[model samples]
Target chain A: MNDLGWIDAALTAARPQAVSALLRYFRDLDTAEEAFQEACLRALKTWPQNGPPRDPAAWLIMVGRNAALDEARRKKKQTELPEDDVLSDLDDAESALAERLDGAHYRDDILRLLFICCHPDLPAVQQIALALRIVSGLSVKEIARAFLVSESAMEQRITRAKRRVAAADVPFEAPGAPERAERLGAVAAMIYLLFNEGYSASGGSVQVRVPLCEEAIRLARLLLRLFPAEPEIMGLAALLLLQHARAKARLDGEGNIVLLEDQDRGLWDRELIAEGLALLEKALRHQRPGPYQVQAAIAGVHAHAAQPEDTDWAEIEQLYGALERHQPSPVVTLNRAVAVSKVRGPAAALAMIEPLAQPLAGYFHYFGVKGWLLKELGRADEARTAFDRAIALANTPAEAEQIRQHLDRLKEGAQRKSGRGSAHPAQS
Target chain B: MLYAILCYHDEAEVGSWPKEKDDAVLAKRALVTDKLAAKGRLGPVVRLMPTTAATTVRAGREPLVIDGPFAETKEQLLGFYIVDCASLAEAIEAAKGMVKDGGGAMEIRPLRLFRPGTTAGALAAESVAP
Candidate 1:
């Protein structure tokens, strides 16, 4: 629909692999990042007219590498730098560049780059942030928004990350099993974080940030290909797929958070459900489950349900119990409380999470869950207070609105019980 | 066939190496390196100075000189290895077992092959191919 139709498609298709390859070549995050940007600049100028090349990833990698190198050289000649237009016209050399960099060379460069980004030295946050910024080509502002950090802070974080990699001089080679295993956890964690950023959107924006989810899924698939028999990796990929399947029903028409039990089952993406289900089945066949696989299996059960009532709440609760065994945390307990409510009523669920209050005091979801449980227990006063706290801690406007809805419902219920008119104006 | 086992550590990661932990780490590294040398895999093991001794240069501009590392952060390159091995997989497998002295960190990368008559593209292809 836009002027540069084919070019856009080509860039979209090639970007992940191309950027992955460039990252391998440069080893430095900034260098790889700058190279990809340079490639895009050239593509915008050239691909509109001469058309995309035979292999877009290869084309981009080759041209991007040359452009990056040229820029490096040009920096050396900065005072006598060539005219801007002449330097930019290098975009026209796509075919020659592709001819020079083709086939197997292309594949390894990218694989190496992906491997490097997963270096065991970086923390999970830095690893994911670096991959998103360097490999997926997200801007600092965009990444910062996803992380709820300031742009300058995120920029500093990424800059520091790149410097660390450079100082480490992390190699550009496919590591063996032991090394791969250590790095794999980091890579899998990064991909999952990428998907979560997309999945957790508060639904206020018109654009759903679906591309990030798609990119994460694509990277997960690519990673699984690299390590086909790793059970945890299989679990990680399946988990994302299953979770992503429910994207459609997560938000309501007014963009409020729709609890899973309240979602319209028919609206869920069946194709994604089918793929996710198939993947979970395959992962289970490994007969060696990890936390991610167990979580995916739980998601699978929810996805298979035709209606909220049909959901196998007991089974879901059991899976959450297992997940806790595998990776214990208050968050897992908080999630299990929902399923506990379904199986054993609100009182049992309340008992389960109350012990968690001290640790989870500042957590929005914890208070939100507490508010919902208290409301279900006919404890309106306590519920309103919890909802007020939840609203105060809300990460987005939609979250605040969701808590307000609970408060409004509680007020309406109280008015009906007393046979008296409501005193306060209700939020929609 | 020489492998460089480089140690790595993230500055902000929880749980630094304690004294007993440092002793255990050194013991493990010594054990692994001895095992490698026993099997004729170890070439030379040397720990690099911290990133404080590092310098970086792009293509130009007086190398944009700075004090210490280009970026200031907690993670640093601790050390490395040069070992003889038949293949990359073997080298990397050995490298993974190499830990930081005093609980620092390490990483392993096969030296990029810079053969005569081969273009950078050809070498890049061979090194990078999946």
Candidate 2:
């Protein structure tokens, strides 16, 4: 690997521990971040010459702490700071901190930092923005592009989140078991949002933003390590893996959206699917079924089917029913309707979602599904109207193109009928 | 660290409880508080009257006085406890003890001493030793 490539990987891996440990020392987000940046600058200068340190995280934490102190001292003294060479040599302090960085301390520091970023006082948007900026270390401009917002707006949002967190007075110490359990739900939700931010790809090329998905998976794995026996966490990790396994087949050659049933199954990642299935099996055995477990069970069912025709639609429908009971919402009902259509028929599925029309009027998938069901039932006029609505609500060009394809099929069918009518006027 | 555990319960359900039932719940809370006191984690406990007795002040070009809680939710804040603990887990454990059998939820928020212009050097030196 190239020198800078290895340095990048080392920096990304060391970020959580180094930044968290520095946060522990500094007790301020901005200070901790500035210290981390200074340490990184030092590493960029020294690692190329001295080779990498034995423990990059420990070295960064020690060096970052001292660098921040040096800055404070420099500001107080109003004199020249120390030379780069003097600051970069840290053989003794690095090993000393490495000795003190025990497993419990490391886990708690990382968890504490995550909890601070996802503090309950902040709104969901702010939580996501802060976590992306602090934990994943995404640049403000990149995050702004992902969310389709101005960089200044995202910067303001992150600053406001930090201010709220500091004002809320999050504890600096390691959380206890009960507190960890309490915070797990919020943390899980944040991770899911992170994954969705990458998975949805509402704007821009999805291939370029797939790193968010990988980062989210890494965070979920870290959470799984902390709560190994927690079934919901296992289910969550499994769910993301199963969904992401199909990423390669999610679009066609021209980048048009491909429905799950039409996608090439061979393109799916078998390793990720295998890992997800194993986790789902373990989670189901735990029997403490929650929303995540139910959703994972549904995804597991889909993954197990080698071909679309072999899918157990009945089981998927039942799982969605269980999910609906566990977490009742209009969106959940709309999803369950898809399984309903597969198990029963279009008529039954249409009736199932008829009551959801008012609530899901603005929902894109609702109209798309309604249009498909209408088309199946030979209700051409209503189907066309629904497809039009779906196109209007589409969030991406691919989504709109999917609906337009349906409209094109409808037009073709109409033209064939009219041409047959011209040939056989008595039958018409 | 200090945390305030705010208890929320459906007002209508709480209002319908019998006197003896209410007394039993309060008795359970007292037991938890006594245990916390023994552990030297107990802090000030405040039990507020219902939202009906609340008055809200809104400032604008003309100050407006509004009656009742800030927002109408099914659950209303009924009481609170400030507890001293080493971590959030301890505070949550303490809060659980109070609301074990009570049909309500508690929210734990860490209390901050807002000190502006505080440098990190002093805190770092005090907390970390080489």
Candidate 3:
């Protein structure tokens, strides 16, 4: 408690709960934020000398509510101050909540706090910004740096998002089961979007924003805490963990993209792998297979294999099939084709993705995979054409460079042969 | 021997709980503590702040600071209890009694106490007693 670092952490850990409870009191985002800040300021002054409160959130809530009410009264606002007995009732409620409130109610409070930030009315960027600002307690400057935007712009964006949430009149009452599930789905998707915002940055123009990924993980963990029994939430957390476990090995020191098969397995974070596997196993036991669970299971298989040669591509292909059944998409099939190439022959894989040409024409990975399959089949000219199109469609310089490597191989294969080509250029 | 029983749990839910709910949890655990206290075996019990509020200082060739607990364990260490135990088996038994139903682990470690100011060079001359 005497340590400033500890105080900082305690305040951060207490933010969602204190702010949400304050929101319950004031029913306004700005007011709740101001009150929580005030409480934190007071904690800094008092806690170092006296030691931490038994329950930091509860202490902050009581103090914040009083501070807000006092300010309102001092300003002589018409905001009806509850009678003195009402104050006692507030204390009674806080002190006797074991008899009044169950774990589910508090869970909803936190969920509602998170769900409000990700209202459907908000755009994807705004939703991510708001969640980082409110739920994760990221400073505007910190978030701006992560997203590569100006601090003022990020602050304005968060402010606008919060205003939109308030204008949407999102009901604060504990939602019905169906509505709660719907809100949870939206929240989960928003978190995934946040993670992808960071995870998708492959260096170059957009520097890899690891903090965004870390913050997204923290938000997922917080959501898991609120809904421990939800298997999909478990899968969601597991997926992020397993994917992030390979973060260090995903790119080389030269900032070139490293394919999963080419990655150094020893660089992967084993602790995260173990935690992810534990969560995935627990989720699978629930028998409620969702998209996230299937994806996590795929990552799980990759994690279980120590070496690329030991990879169970067959299981990965099957999982992708199940994923398609759950949520059909051409992109998913394109990903599955790469696995098909590893398990079956290149011809089989090429035939599989032949139909995806129109649907995935604009997708970079589609052409990249097509080129790889064509190269494996010793179709030099066709592989070169596919590699050319892939380079054109690549999102980053690193992506373009990978395709360029394939094109270079095609050129070498053509040069060494007197005629066009026979087959198996690499083998020869 | 003295054993330090560390409690690890997912503190996101516990830390954010309201006063009465937090009290109810502690009181229920007090049921286990009461027996130990009666036997004069319990030394001290502490409930710590969540890991979010933690900071780590690395004492390498050059001092460095980092945010968060930097703990490698899956669950965060939420609290601890010091108790007098006859043997490692006794410490394990004490730990099992303290573990409430949840997703966490209890690690019991043998400890030594050093009273720095008791003598000119007070090493482990006097151990903590309850």
Candidate 4:
């Protein structure tokens, strides 16, 4: 079919691969993106009647590079071109890029994956913004609108992000075979970070940037296609899909954070959940439990629960224990405590987190969980104090508001038992 | 008349859609396919992977091998449906039913040549209610 829609889809699917390859060639984000555009223009003029090339990305990459070079040569005709040595510092970088890109298993080009993943320190939000703008080939205005920022402000933000990427040391040495695992890990983390940035639990609709989440999922799928057998890659893809399945249900009409138990399960996307569950099953079958697998297993547990009351808290606690073993952060332990409270009692979970106070002192989720545990124990005054801290530390107004609602409920409960001074007696 | 309805759409736009949206589109299309299948008129329906995975072997001086789809055109030949319809009007109606949501191209052409193909469905189900 020579339909424009078909052509558009072909160009869109090939964009990241084509542009990323061009970026590696040109060593400039703007130049690569511009070249990709020029190449698309040519493809439009020729592809319809001619039928699609065997590989769209390889086609676009070859065409874009030539078009960019032709334009560059024309523009610099009067001026001297870059000395071949300057642009072709290929002795080390060529091998390194090849090693990394090859590990991703691209069929057409060996050194054509992504430059953005190599720039590691762009901060979460900026990393995502840069990826969307450069590698994803989204317009500055479109990115700004996605992030709910002004167009010019977004333009400056992207420029700054690009400058930071430009400043980072270009990698040279090809990583060893063992380092291939680490290489894929970095790229996977980058994609997950992008998803989390788009999946902020608060600030309502304003904070939930749909494009970022979608883009991250897309990247994860691309990564999975390369290393389909690698359990962790499957888990990474599954985790993003599983988490994103509930994107619409995670926030309320007011944009307040809705905990899993309270979320409208009907709002969840069954298709994504099914895909995620299938991938997670495949990952578990590999029996190579890693951090991503552990986390995805946790999400799988949530998705598998038909109702909040049906959740297997014991299984969840075990998964959290597994996660803590893999990652071993106080945050994981804090998450574990939620399950602990459900399986055992509030006192046991409270004891579990008591030592974590020093480590999770300023974290919002920590206090929120602690406050809920305290309220369950009928330690109303302490619960109120913890909630106050949670509100103060919350990431967004919606989060703060959620804690405020909790505090209000606590006050209402205390008022109902007016004369009971500071506590409640045991049921026994 | 036996017809091959070729499906085509912009890859980028479809790829960008959230998983839930993609599922909804499939769910709607199932409504159309069920009726066709019930009548024993539906054939194999397939959704091709991204064009990157495609390999085209151009039969030339030495049968040249290329990297992507055979025809790098605007929209892609994403998938196809085979239907046994009484007339072109019936086939067009089937094409329209398949794309009820209305964003892709479905080119319906009468098959000049024929072969027995593997059936994806048993085609023994009762009527698919509207």
Candidate 5:
């Protein structure tokens, strides 16, 4: 790899450890961030000449901590600035620090940093924005583009989040087992939220926000490293991989939404599917089926199907049934109705979701499914009304367009029948 | 390390309960506190009045006092417990022991330690000197 490429990879790999350690020393977000930046600048200048450090994280931590201290001393006028040779000399100290960080200190520091970003006091949006900024090291502008918000608004959101985190006074100590479990749950939820933000990108903008999905997958892999034996973590990672493998066929070339049944299965990434299936198998063998594991199992069924008709709808329905019992929600039932339509018929599917209307009144998928069932039953007028509601509640332009196409089909059927009736008027 | 377990609950639901039911719930919490005290993990336990009796003051040139909690949410802060433990895990166990069945939520936050000369405004010149 080129020098810049190597430097970039090293920095990305080192950020979690180096920044976590710096945050420990400074006890403040802005100060820790400033120190990390200075270290990065020094790396850009010195790495090309001195060659990469044996432990990049250790090198960054030592240099960043000293730089911040130097700035502090300079502000007080108590000591002169260090000579260039002294500032850059980190061979012995970096090795010692690296040795110390290899112990339990490494995992705790990174996990604590992640927990702070997803602290309960912050809203979900702020939690996501903060994690993207601090953990993933995305620039504010880059994060703004991914969320489809303006730069200034995203900046304010991040600033406010940082202020709240500092005020909240998160602990610097390693969490105990129970607390680790709680924090792990929080982190998993945050990662899922991040993936959804990318997955649900609306209108013609599906490709613009794909980086969020990749980042979430990356963080999930990191979590798996920390808790390798935890089945749910494995399940979570597998679920994201299985779903993301279909990104290529999720939308057509014209940026329109494509239903899974109609999508070209050839476009799916087999490598990711294989990895997901392996993880799901291992997780299921653990005999602890959580919501994520059940969902991954369902996705695994889809991945194993080579053709659309080959999909095992019966197993999917059972998995959804398990999911409903595990974490009951109206949305789960709505999804199960689709499987029911395949296994049974449109009548049973319609009956299944008829009771969900009151609870899912504003839900777009509710109306979409209702419209499809109504259309299948030859109740065109009711289906048209349902489609109108679905369009009104559509989250993105692509989703709205998908419903509009269905409406057009109904319109054509009506026009054909009316034209036939007029041509037979003399016989009548 | 000292951790604060802040308990939040639906105020309306709690307020409508009978006095006997409230006392019974409090009795269960007291049992948990007694257990923690035996282990030397318990600290101060404080229960605040309802949000109806709360006030907020915004600092500025002139302070603005709002007559409710800082923000309106589904759950309101009803009480808190301070627990001293070796690590966050112990503190969480203590908090979980006290939580009632069907309770709303508990937020665990660590309290900052007070050191003499670590203020952001004050430069730690002596410590920084090479």
Candidate 6:
């Protein structure tokens, strides 16, 4: 194979195992990261000429481990360096390492690595930054661009996080069963953050950060594999799959924000939806409801609908209620209010969200949803007020436009309802 | 080749250790060191003073020049051991026995080694640490 193809294949195949092994070898985040980069450079130079290896991950890990060891030895000036052939023979060495690193090893290294990056000690922003940097192989520049922050700032943030990990002296071992269960919640939250970071990509002509989304989904799947019996993990994976199923329909020809109601159902990825729904059904069958499962059930309700109007808003509202009990937050309540408006009339949703005005004041989505509910209730003044707040807090032009459309519709509805005495003229 | 298992203990616990127990604690550590020596694992082991005798320096800005360790931490670095181990896993396993029940925590960290040559060689290696 050509160099590019070979490099891509090697990276794709070896990434999980190599990273896992490096985490095992170095224990320090920065050292492990540096070691991996060294191994990759060697692979690029040698792999194309030698063709692909049998066990790419193992090959990369072995080469990287030896390289790290070699560098360490050279640092101490302790002994002569090993021969090149030994370092380059990754294909043979990887199989040996793979045998040694089976089930427990996989958990201790890769999954635990995920858990470490999302350690509760690190701030959420730092958690996402560290995960993107260490796990996804994204450079600080790439992560900075994705975050729309300065490269130097992002670099400093990542460095500070690594130092925290080092200073905190977080365990390098795979935590025991009790510890794993406790920390799993934090890990799942981090993965979802990764997905949302990509899912909620701000303005500009670019599409979503497909890799981040894909990697988050991939991590979720890996987590499911580890905890096949855990309903929440299953629900989380299902939720992402279902949400991503609509990726194609999420944008129009002009790359604008297509509301859930406006999206073309036909364009949705049925394969993803089916897989998502199946996983959701399996999770629900466990009869052990949790936040992720409830949210997944809500998504499942939407996925089952043939048209937007066919949505089971009553069930969705119920699922949202269960979700609130499991993991209540202002955001969940705001979303549930939308379902409330669809099922119990706009007045009910308006009542549901009225108490949330204080906490959700600065949140754009809160006002946007509130505006829609008020507009539905024929309360044009309050609806416009909410819409204005939403527009003011809008993160992008697209979000602003979506809120503006609601305000326009509200004014038009008022004008039609009040006949010729309407104070405000509706504008297109 | 050299790994450090830095022991972090509660300062209150260390403060309460009776003066009569000092030599006994040292004797216990000496026993542990002797056992490690038999297995060719011992390198350097030292018991540090309480966190009161520690200093911290940040990379930038006028150093806060704190009198004590980083913070009013319940866990303070009590002691450390440098062990020669083949791998990180080995080092961690070796460090596990260093802590007594409800006494302290040990942090096993591998020392970094930067070489004059091919240090750059490892830079782009893509060795992922999980």
Which runs of model 3 end up more than 4 angstroms from their true locations? A77-102, A202-204, A412-428, B2-4, B8-10, B13-130
Alpha carbon lDDT at A138, candidate 2: 77
lDDT of 3 by residue, A46-127 (tens): 9878766766777788788778767766654465555543244345344323412345666677788888987877888889
TM-score leader: 4
DockQ scores for all predicted structures:
0.01, 0.01, 0.05, 0.12, 0.01, 0.01
For model 2, residues A190-292, the per-residue Cα lDDT tens digits are 8888887777765654422466776787677667655656789888988888888888887788887777777788888776676677667667766799998
Residue-wise C-alpha lDDT for candidate 6, range A1-428, written one tens digit per residue: 21154355336535655686676656666667777888898888887677546555666777777787687757546555455432343333335445444755765577667777876688877898988788767789988887778999999999988887777665755688888887688889998888877776654434466666767776677576556667788889888888887888876777666788777888887756766776776677668888888877887787787777687889988888888888889888888887777777778878898899899888889888877766666777887887898889877776776677677767666756533221111100
Q: After superposition, how far is residue B129 of candidate 2 from its true place, in Å?
A: 55
B77, model 5: CA deviation in Å?
A: 51
Write the residue-wise lDDT of candidate 2 on B43-87 in tens digits.
667666445434466888899765446765646798788888899
The 10 consecutive residues of candidate 5 chain A with the worst lDDT sum are: A419-428
lDDT for A277 in candidate 2 is: 70
| Best prediction by lDDT | 5
Estimate every model's Cα lDDT from 0 to 1.
0.66, 0.74, 0.74, 0.71, 0.75, 0.69
| Docking class for candidate 2 | incorrect
- Model 3 achieves a DockQ score of 0.05
lDDT of 5 by residue, A149-200 (tens): 8999999999999999889887877788998898888888899888878887
**Model 4: per-residue lDDT, tens digit, A1-428?**
41355566567677777776666667666787888999999999998778667566767877787787677767656567655432343223333234333533342221223435346676666777777776666788987777777999999988888888777744433445565666677777778888877887333336566677888888777666545567888789789888888888877888766767777888887767766776777777768899998888888888877677777889989999999988899989988888888789789999999999999998888888888888888888899899889888877786777788778778777646433122111100
DockQ of 6: 0.01
Instruction: Provide the TM-score for each candidate, comma-separated.
Output: 0.62, 0.68, 0.74, 0.76, 0.70, 0.69
- Ranking of all candidate structures by their TM-score, best first: 4, 3, 5, 6, 2, 1
Flag regions of model 2 displaced more than 4 Å.
A79-101, A120-123, A203-208, A414-428, B1-130
What value of lDDT does candidate 3 attain over all alpha carbons?
0.74
Candidate 1's displacement at residue A43, Å, is 5.6
lDDT of 6 by residue, B81-118 (tens): 87778888877766665554233568987767523344
